[model samples]
Target: MIVSITGATGFIGRRLVQKLAEGDHEVRVLTRSKENAKLLFPVEKFPKITIAGEFEWKDCIQGSTAVVNLAGMPISTRWSSEVKKEIKDSRTRVTSKVVDLINGTSYDTRPSVLISATAIGYYGTSETKVFDERSPSGNDYLSEVCRVWEAKALGVDKDVRLALIRIGVVLGKEGGALAKMIPFFMMFAGGPLGSGNQWFSWIHLDDLVNLILEALKNPSYKGVINGTAPNPVKLTEMCEKLGEVTGRPSWLPVPDFALKAMLGEGATIVLDGQKVLPLKAQELGFSFKYPYVRDALKAIISL
Candidate 1:
């Protein structure tokens, strides 16, 4: 199978590309810089590198069995009005381009599946709610972005199967929310972001990539699937687990106002969270390698 990926240099996307390449699939990546692409997967290690520019999807997507769209602006920083526009455009615009390419391609040559990225933030910052793929979207900055992003993916022609992975916080050794918090934990300054009650739905990086591969290979894996662990843990529990794994203290606290002041509206990315569960994936016979927070943290920290 030929797999074409956007945002191929990103944390998860690059790893997905490497995995697909190792699976003996033809992997093509859409990147802005050939130099950066080489840096991501050295030519010596990954001998076959098919590089395409941001607008060159039409050229690169030919003969692809799947096209995975993971391009977007990071929502981890302060969200000024300008930055918000960038956050919205970075997702919607790129998705629009991908849709256009799929629509324009000839029937026999177009990719069969579109596995686009969404976030668990679609459920919003609900401390009390248990969200699944069937839940209605929440009214928040990130939720709105996710709604539009999924809508664009759904607009594709009926011939293409669309799988919108509503992703949660991914726990991994390389990079992600865990990478940002590891230093603080190592220094014994790590704790829950705000009120420790809020739920932190997360998935192991390997599980997330495997979910995408499942969507790519299985025709029945269509529509929205929550990309989160089955057992969601409270923020405090997550912190405590991290501390246990690293032999550090998880007693410190970060005030909500301080996070708000530092990150503006973007603070909600950490300050608030959703209790998301992967019901669809489970019903479709998917199993997670790290279903518990303690096990997930231990694996990541040891790496």
Candidate 2:
């Protein structure tokens, strides 16, 4: 399959490209800087992979079997007013551009599938309820961002198969929520945040990638699918598991007010939480290699 991807240098996109390349698929990446792309991907080894400048829409989408849109501003940064606009505009603009490109092009030039990225924040911050693909979006900042992002993505021509993966906190060794927590956890300084009662929907990086592959292969999979583990964990439980895996203690608690004061609205991603379930993915017969948080943390930490 010929796959074109935006944000190919990002954490998940980098890994997805590598995996697709290893599978002997033709992969084209849309990036801002070719030099950085080379530095990040080291294309010398993977000849099937090609990196090009940011979405010259038609140029990037032409002759591709699928287009995976992962381009967006990072949510981990402090949510300044400007940064918030950037976060919204980054996603919506890219998605709108892609849709326009596909619509403007001939049928032969357009991709068959459009796989877009979103976040589980679509379900909002819930304490105990488990949200699935059918769940209504919440009114929070992240949730609104996700709604707009997905809406733009789905605005592509009706002929194309559109699939949106509403992702959760991905646990990976190199980079992600896990990487940020490992050092503190290893030093026995990591603990639950706020009241530690909020639910955290998480997924292993491998599982997330595999789920994407599955979605690409299965024509029946469409709309929003939760890219998360079936077993959701509470904030306190996740912290305790990390401590257990690293042989540390998680007795300290970061106050919610302090986090909000420090990160602004961005803190809600950590302080407020959601219990998301990968119901559609599971029903499609996708199996998770790392279903439990403890085992996933152990594998990532060992790496």
Candidate 3:
């Protein structure tokens, strides 16, 4: 199968591309820098893969069996009005472009599956609620971003299988939120952010990549699916587990006020969270390698 992927250089996208290549599938990565993509995924190793710039999306997506749309700006920053517009435009505009391309293509020529990325932020921050794919969407800033992003992807023709993978806080050693937090924990300054009571719905990077693979192969696995582990942990418990995994102290906590001052509205990403479960993924027989926070933390921190 030939797979066309946007945001192919992102943290999750990189691993996903490698996995597809390892499975002996042809990959066309839609990137702004073909040179950089080649450096990361060498031609000798990933000979089946090719990298092309955004202007070449038509060529990159042509004859593809699957199109994984992961293009979007990183949301972890001070949310100035300008940054907010960038965030919204980054997701909505790219998705609209892909949907238009897919819609314009002939039914037989178009990709069969469109596996797009969304997030648990669609559910909003709620300590008491356990959200599944069927849960109603929240009206927060992140939620609005996810809502519009998924909306555009869903606009693809009915002939295509659309898998909206609502990702959670991905735990891995290489990149993502864990990479940013591990350094502080290793230095013994790590602790819970904000009140530490917020529920954290997270998944191991390995599990997430596997879930994507499953979506690609399963025709019936369409619609929304949470890319989270079965178990959700409180922020405080997560910090404690990370501390244990690294053999460091989890005593020093960052106050909510301090985080708000530093990150502005972006602090909500760390200070607030949701209790999300991969109900649909599990129902579709997708098992997670790391379902618990302790085991996930140990695996990531050990690396």
Candidate 4:
């Protein structure tokens, strides 16, 4: 199937595009920087990739079978007022635009499916509570942002099979949480972040990309699906597994207060988290390549 993706230059987007192209699917990258997208998916390397300019989003969507929305600002930063605005706007605004482009297309021409990325932040930080796709959304700042982000996506016509993936902490090499933690572990100074009791609901990058692919191709994948592994470990346990995989000791700990001081409101992402499970995905018979934290850590860190 032909797929049009927004934020095609992002971490998940990049991997998803490559996997889709490898499966002989035509991919249209609706991006702000055609040159950058070109560099990332060069014609010599990816002949099926079409780097659509900023103005060609509608044209691209009309010709595609599905559209994946992964565009968003990095939230792992100091949450100043301006940064917060950027974080919210980047997801909600871009998603609104994508929906509008899809809505404007004729029924026969518009994409049949829309797979959008929301985060587990939608459920807020809850160490005690377990969350599934059916759970109610939280009332935190990030929750509001995700709520608005998904609301914008809901603007798509009912004919579109909308799949909103509430992604958890992504574990992978080169990027995601591991890149920041692995260096400290390699130097033998790594430990759990914050209070260490927070739930660390995570998914292997490969599994996440596969989930998106499944959502894109399977009509049964409509509605909310938690993009997380079945096993949800606490931050302390996750750190222990990381330490084991990296051949280091989980001794030192980053205090919650210290992290709060450094990242401000952004600290909630690491200091507190919800235990999200892939209930919907499992119901649909989706398989996770790396379900356990220890094994997931080994797959990434060992590489």
Candidate 5:
């Protein structure tokens, strides 16, 4: 099978690309920087990987089994007017181009499916609400971004199956929420980010990749699927688990005001969170290797 991926240099995209290469499928990494993609996936190790730039992106997607769209600006920093515009445009604009490419393809050359990335932030942050794929989109900046992002993906041809993965916080060894939090724990200054009561809906990176693979292969994997572990936990609980695994104390607490001051509006991502669950994945008979927060933490720390 041929798979074309955008955002191939990102945290999730890099792992997804590696997994696809391991499966021995032809992988085309569509990036603005073919040079960077080549750096990440050298011919020496990833012999089956092809690097594609904007000029070749259309050709790479033609007749491809799947086009996995994961490109976007990272939402893990402070927000200014310019930065907010960047975050929104980075997703919606890219998605528009992908849709145009897919829709413009000849009937026989169109991709079979389009697996696009969204975020659990679509549900917005609420200390009390538990979100599933069926929930309505929230009325925040991130939620609006997600809504527009998915709408753009929905423009794909009627024959092409579309799976919008509304991802949660991904826990991994190299980079992600875990990477940011681990250092604090190692220094015995780690604890919950804000109130310690916000939900930390998360998935192990491997589980997330597996879910994407399932979506790629299974016809049943259409529409919105929450890419989160079955079990969600409060930030405080997640901190406790991290403390246990790393043999560090969960004592220091980051004040909510501090997070807000630092991240500006972006602080809502961590200071307030939604309890998102992978209900669609469950209905589709998907299983997670690390369902619990502690187990997920153990697996990550062991790595």
Candidate 6:
């Protein structure tokens, strides 16, 4: 199968591309620069991969079996006015362009499926209950971003089978939330941010990649699926797990006011949390390798 992917150089995108390549699928990556794409994903070893610049969408989508739209600005940075606009534009504009290209062009050789990425932020920070695919979206910055992002993706032509994955915090050995917290945890400085009672929905990278692969192969897996572990742990539990995994005592806690002062509104992502469940994915026979936080933390820290 031929696949076209945007944000192919990003943390999750890069891993997803590698998985697809290993599965013997041809991949065309949309990048800002062909040179940078080559640098990120070497074409010599993986000749089935093609790297093209931004405007190559129409050409790249043609003759593809699937398109995974993961292009977006990182939300972890401080949300300045400019940064917020970049985040919105990068996701909505690029997605709109891809949808137009697929619907307007690609008629004869159009991809059969479109897998777009979203976030658990779609549910917002709910202190009361767990959110599933059927739950209504929350009203927050991240939720608003997700609302528009998913809307743009869903606007794709009715002929295509579209799947939106509302992803949670992805735990991985590389550059994810866990990686950044390891050093602090190792030094026994790890503790919950803010109140520590907020619920956190997360998924291991291996499971996340496999979930995408399953979605690619299963026609029944359409619509919104929570790309998260079934077990949702509290923020305090997460901190405790990290501390235990690293054999360090979690003796410190970062106050909500301090976080807000340092990160501004962006601190909401860490200080506030949502409990999300991958109910649809589980019903569709998707199993997580590390459903528990302790095991996931151990696996990542051991690496």
Please give the range of 10 consecutive residues that has the lowest summed lDDT in model 1: 48-57
What's the TM-score of every candidate structure? 0.97, 0.96, 0.97, 0.98, 0.98, 0.96
Q: Give lDDT tens digits, candidate 6, residues 1-303.
A: 899999888888889999998989999998887888898888677789989887787888988889999899888767888888898889999899889888976577998899999999998887788899999988877889899999999998988999999999999978777876777776767888888989989999888989988888899989999999999898899999888888888769878887788778788888888899999998998888999988988898888
Poorest 10 consecutive residues of model 4 by lDDT?
A: 172-181
**Top lDDT hit:** 5
Which has the higher lDDT value, candidate number 2 or candidate number 4? 4
Off by over 4 Å in 4: none
Candidate 2 TM-score versus the reference: 0.96
Candidate lDDT values, in order: 0.89, 0.87, 0.89, 0.91, 0.92, 0.88
Better candidate by TM-score, 1 or 4: 4
Model 1 TM-score, all chains together? 0.97
Tens digits of per-residue lDDT for model 1, 102-168: 8889999999999999999888888888899999999988889999988898889999999999999
Q: Which parts of model 6 have CA positions greater than 4 angstroms off?
A: none
Q: What is the alpha-carbon lDDT for the whole of candidate 4?
A: 0.91
lDDT of 3: 0.89
Deviation of model 3 at 214, angstroms: 0.3
Candidate 2 local lDDT, 189-297, one digit each (tens): 7899889999889999999999888888899789888999989899999999999888889988878887888788788888889888888988888889999999888
Model 4: per-residue lDDT, tens digit, 1-303? 999998889888889998998899999999998989999998999999889987888889997899999999989888999999999999988999999999999988989999999999999878789899989989999999999999999999999999999999998896777788898898898899977899999999999999999888788999999999999999999999999988899989978887889899888889888899999999999999998999989988768
Write down the lDDT that model 1 would get: 0.89
